[model samples]
Target chain A: MAFENYVNSNESYTSNQFYEKLLREIPDLIFQFKIEKDNTYSMPFVSNSAMEIYGFEKDFLEHDAGPVITDRILKEDVKAFLKSVLKSRDTLTRWNHEYRVLLPKKGVRWLKGSAKPEAMKDGSVVFYGRITDITANKEQELRLVLSEKRFEFALEASMGGVWDWNLVDNTVFYSEQSMKILDLDETEGINSFENCISKVHPDDQKEYLSDIDLHLKGITDVYENLHRVKGRKGTYKWILDRGKVIERDKSGKPLRIIGTHTDISSQKEREDELKKTLDIVSEQNSRLLNFAHIVSHNLRSHAGNFTMLLDLVDDIQDSSEREETLQHLRTISNDLTQTIEHLNELVSIHTEIKIARENLNLYEFFQRTLNVLSEKINKHDVKIISLIPDDIHINYNPAYLESILLNFTTNAIKYSNPERRLEITYQLTYEKGKKVLTISDNGLGIDLEKYKDSLFGMYKTFHQHPDSRGIGLFITKNQVEAMGGKIEVKSKVGEGTAFKIYFNEKV
Target chain B: MKKFNDVFVVDDDKVYHFILKNLLKKNNIEVNSRFFENGHDAIEGLKENSKNGTTLPDLILLDINMPVMDGWQFLEEFRKIKGTLNKETVIYMVSSSNSPFDLNKAKDFPNEIQDYFLKPVCLEDICRIFLN
Candidate 1:
């Protein structure tokens, strides 16, 4: 009734005057509607802006909205428009609704309507309201929603999830992908620093903590850690974690640390497998080298026999000596033929012995070796005084050490002073970061001044012993060098001889 | 008259001693000779014979590859006692190995190994040293 009073009395001017004033003063579409007792509604005042908004003639909207407005309202929003009108009809309250309209040439447009309702004494209702073109705001809102969805899709494709740890609040947020990488349920999971640390393998925790500390101290620009974290399946998985302090407070305290985690378990396993394969290849190479040495040695022995028989056949004098020489020559020929047959089958002298370097318990090894040579030692009454300490360990190949010790011990025994009990002393010490092993013996000492050059030569003998094939020292020297060590000798004619081996550890 | 008074043949190969003794006999060298099995036996014999002031060899032929003691090992101990010896003994180093390495090694011992002889020593190889 109050809105009707304004509509009926305040209309000092005619309906055309009020609408003409509205067209000049107002930029929005304005309207006034009155319903008759017969339930027919007519818009008494529909401004000229309606012609601009709906692209229709001003006379076209002056009729009851039953055909014009109802047909123009979007099909989907027609109920919302009707609901607002019905609420305004009974309650006599304000009507406000946003809806869409399909116009003649302007296509679809968005509009907002607001009106105050009044009841007339003639059992009719009147409404004075305004409709706004809100298409720009709605389009901008739709664009924002579309861009957000595109960003989320891109993140999912990258398998990347943002994570932020609020250092100040001691709280953590793991995005869906990040939670899934940590083996935590992506939909429902909370990852705090304590839980993350607990998931990390205990052995890697110290290194992880140290790296984080370095990053926190600003020593590193970013925190990087390659470590293993226990998964839901209870197996540890390797993770390549990279993070940086994304935000800091005024006092330079870290406010947030954001990062990403990549599952690198398969890559780490591949590296380990490659290393094992390399080890196998190296072992095979060593076996092949040993086979080559033995083959050469066999060839040389055969060649030596051939030359010896050739000499015997070249000279024959008396009939008795000729018969004997021919017989010996025939036997040597048979031996050489057998050696040639051996050449067809490649023989590895020490193929089964893989060179493994580790800390060697010298005392235990020395005792084991002494037992092996105990028979000869006891026969010769040799005293092997091991000056090496029980705790002295050397980084050397086990087989090389065994061969070197055996050669030195045997050489000492063979050249022992026949007039006295043989005395051999062995000791080990570190010299300039290299192990120096000295094996000295009070035996028939070598005349170093005369035979020093040929001491380590093949088939070069320094002492006259029946069993001296003159190959031991040469092979011993080779074994020492193959293990990255060097051998040297010092001797005095009547005093003694000492063989020293210098071994350096590989880093 | 024979060129040499006595000959010492030190070798592990019985064939060398037999062949050398036969060649010397065939040539009517009329030289007294002693056959030692290896360098050690020869060294000890020479030491004992020299200490007793007995006649030592005028010419010595030593094989390089003999068991118990090699020719090189004998030369080492030979040098130390050579000054105390009574006789002036000419030395020759012989080996079956014709390797250039062994030849070069023999060249180093001018006083001890006067000539290096390879095996299959025809009488000519020995005749060149004494008859020449």
Candidate 2:
């Protein structure tokens, strides 16, 4: 017996009515879709829920709802809906699809449909299916995908890598990009908090740890630090690291922290370059100020002398007296020319871009200087002692070395003590992997305490000697500095003086 | 009676000494003029004259930028011992420097330094110091 006939024989059970009531009560829109041999598509059976889902009347759908159903499906989804139905009919397979449909009362809504297809002996196919509203679920999925894409772009644009630290577990987790930044191999597994900290440069580790500690203790709103980290190929890169405590315990202690590391080495290099250029510019400014002072003071002294001599000539009535004053004027004019020449030499030295240099024997230069001052050395009965090795060589300008040697030697002879026999000693020593030449004399030493500040200043004389023009030491100091060297002096009153010249070998 | 009996000219430049002496002689301000090349010698001469009971110069023409001891150093030393001397001396600072740094520094020693004169000081400047 057929199951419907068997239930009908009892006359009390209404099987068709029971199933129709069940379909009406459910939330889904249940239906049977069909395709005939002539390739015509139709929805032969649809439940009453179509009224709620698509705003259609149940009576109208029960009659011939195929056109209304197709029309209500959005224009963009109609093609895919038809294509899926045809595919299921031809293959006699289960049909599954999600699509959008438009309605009169409501706007566009998402629907999901799933059904099983069966082929009939009359060359027709049928699909029994159900479709529920899936609009809310789809929108949530799209929003998630958009947020993930934005995060990916931010990391790629900044050359940043993410790091997560679980404070409770003391474990560190680095994202794939972080591994690339730290240049760690994939097999290097399970980084501990200590292991991650070891990658920070020793000089920067202190501040980096202190910053995180501050954030953990709630002393800071966010942990931010700029420090160096050991990077690829054993080099260091400056990193702008920032993080925040996302989770905290009841005691307000941090449980988890996440941060980003951005490579900022290039920015740090530019800052250092700016600082160095500023230093050089300020140094040049001070030097220019000093040069201006020299020009003003020296020239004014000569001009003032000329004016005084002219006044004297005007006041004298005698011709011989006037002629004598005129002779003083001539000498003053000569002195003015010499002062101008000295100023010109200083300007040239200051403007020199490249100084010529050669490898010269230091002992030979000293010997030549001694020979040139042989007459004065004998006249003063000064003992010239040379403790310098014959093979000692220096890279320097020839004229500068000769001039420096002669100036020191002559100054020693000139300032020799008259009461005591004077002895001048020259020696070469190596200090800090560089050559230092020392010249010592038992002459009248300067009072370094009183004149140390202006010892190398132009026209600064500390002695009453007739030959003390006070230009030689100033010029010697300029030459020494021009060749990337430095000079220092140690002296005491009534004792002796020693001049030590440090030569830069790398220059 | 002459207002100044003794004068001291402390300067390093020989030409300045010559011109000042000639100008003074020409002006006929008869006084025993003494000269020292530097501040060191000038202070030493002052101390020696004080020890020997000789009269200190009533007028001092001081120059800046001298060797061994500068004008400022001389003033510092002079301030320490000026009260011990029998006579009071007036000091006039003379220098070729027109730097405001030097001029402002001169203002710091008002009691020790009476005036600051730019160099090539004329006979009129000398007359003002002596005749005033």
Candidate 3:
């Protein structure tokens, strides 16, 4: 008998009621769904399972299941549910599907269902199906898929490689991406942990292995280390190696290890370069600061002298005193002009090291310099001895040489000693493969011991002469240095002074 | 009779020395004046004056940027034996540098080092030091 007949024909049997009641005892759903040719849906048969699954009375659903079933189908799955049902009905075949449903009392659930449909003479279709709860299996499938997708994306985006190791057998499986990262094309595949560790740099292998040991010992959650790895060109590249003990035995011993290695060679090089550049910039910045301070002080002195000298000229009334004031004014203004000229020269001297260097004969340049200062030489009655050989030559900037000679010779005559006749000597020689030119004068020699530190410093002078503006040696030093040379001085008080020039000490 | 008994001028610039001397004379406030070309020379003069019972200047105007020793270096040397001097003297840092580095140095100078004056010291600046 049809189960509906059994229930209707033997209502008096308590087992029939017991089974009707037993349907409520279990959670499975049993029902018969039908669709009229008019496409209206209805439930022809619903056991007590309707109340358990749909939270409704069987009697109520047998008459009104059309709206209730479709509405409770979890709107997103309703279309597919209808499509599957229609296809099964039109083909007179079995309907098999898994989908989500809204159980008013149970929030929502995944139901796996199958049904076979039959057609009536009146063109009505009917189906019998059972849908059971499969929420646990569906959720497990989803979590597994999502985790797999995340791991795949991580390896792809990291542009690195993944490695898995079986600790028990000492075997390692390197993914295709991992071999590609290590630039290994052999398809025989990496088979041993020993083989993988052998490719690591000798200096990094010890630490890399220890990290894995620590992770396996349950001392660390993951093996995190950074070291160098041999790359394709036999050059070692910085690699950040990270891994974790993914599986362990009952004794908490490591069973499986998985990890990745990222190339960090370029990043490491950039960091080191930045560190070096920052150091250089800091040193140059300080030197520039000192340069600015000296320049400002020199300019201030000249300007300050001019301010007072002009004011003094305005205050003088006596004709002779006014003339004296005017004379001093001319000298002060001349110093101001020279200071500005020195400043302008420094701009070129520091930045224009590209000046042309020529093989300059020392004697030829000496004769040219003597011509420039012939008037001053005669006025001071100074005797200059040229001890340089006619063939002796040095690579030097012509303009700088001229200025250097003019400054040194003019200073020699201007600061000449009044107690004795002025005699200046020039000598050229080479020491230790370095070309040297020495200029000596019998003028009032400076106390070198006292002024040793500041002899070549800017605006430093020792003489009490009115013409000693303190700019000649400063300029001469700059010019000589620009041509890649150094100046040395030796002096004794009241006797004589000597200046030696070393032409580009290459050795 | 004059306002200042004696003054010591320590500067590298002869033009500054000449201007200062004339300014003192025109203001008619000078007595005997002593001059040193640099801080080193001034230090030596002070040492000699301290050894001999000579008259130390009542006031000293010191310039920075001298050849051998700058005003700061001179002050360092002066602080060593200033206590042995028979006379208490006031010294001023006269410089063309308006840099904060120099000014802060002067502000922290020893008590005997009186004050600082930027270049072109006029009659008024001189009177403020002597009259008080």
Best by lDDT: 2
The best candidate in terms of DockQ: 2
Q: Candidate 3 residues A428-484, lDDT tens each?
A: 888888888888999988888876645555335423233453556766776676666
CA deviation > 4 Å runs, candidate 2: A1-281, A314-331, A358-361, A379-396, A408-453, A459-470, A480-507, B1-4
Clashing pairs for predicted structure model 3, backbone only: none
Which ten-residue region of model 1 chain A has the weakest summed lDDT? A343-352
What DockQ, between 0 and 1, does each candidate earn?
Answer: 0.05, 0.42, 0.29
Between candidates 2 and 3, which one is better according to TM-score?
A: 2
Model 3, stretches more than 4 Å misplaced?
A4-300, A311-327, A345-507, B1-3
Q: Which structure is stronger by DockQ: 1 or 3?
A: 3
Measured over all alpha carbons after superposition, the RMSD of each candidate to the real structure, in angstroms, is 15.3, 7.0, 11.5
Model 2 Cα lDDT, one tens digit per residue, B13-42:
767877887888788878898999888899
On a 0 to 100 scale, what is the lDDT of residue B32 in model 2? Answer: 90
Please identify model 1 stretches exceeding 4 Å from their true place. A1-361, A387-395, A432-434, A462-470, A505-507, B1-5, B12-15, B18-32, B37-58, B64-91, B97-115, B123-132
Question: What's model 3's TM-score?
Answer: 0.52
TM-score of chain B of each: 0.92, 0.95, 0.91
Candidate 2 clashing pairs? none
Model 1 clashing residue pairs (backbone): A1-A119, A464-B68, A464-B69, A465-B68
Better of 2 and 3 by lDDT: 2
Best candidate, TM-score:
2
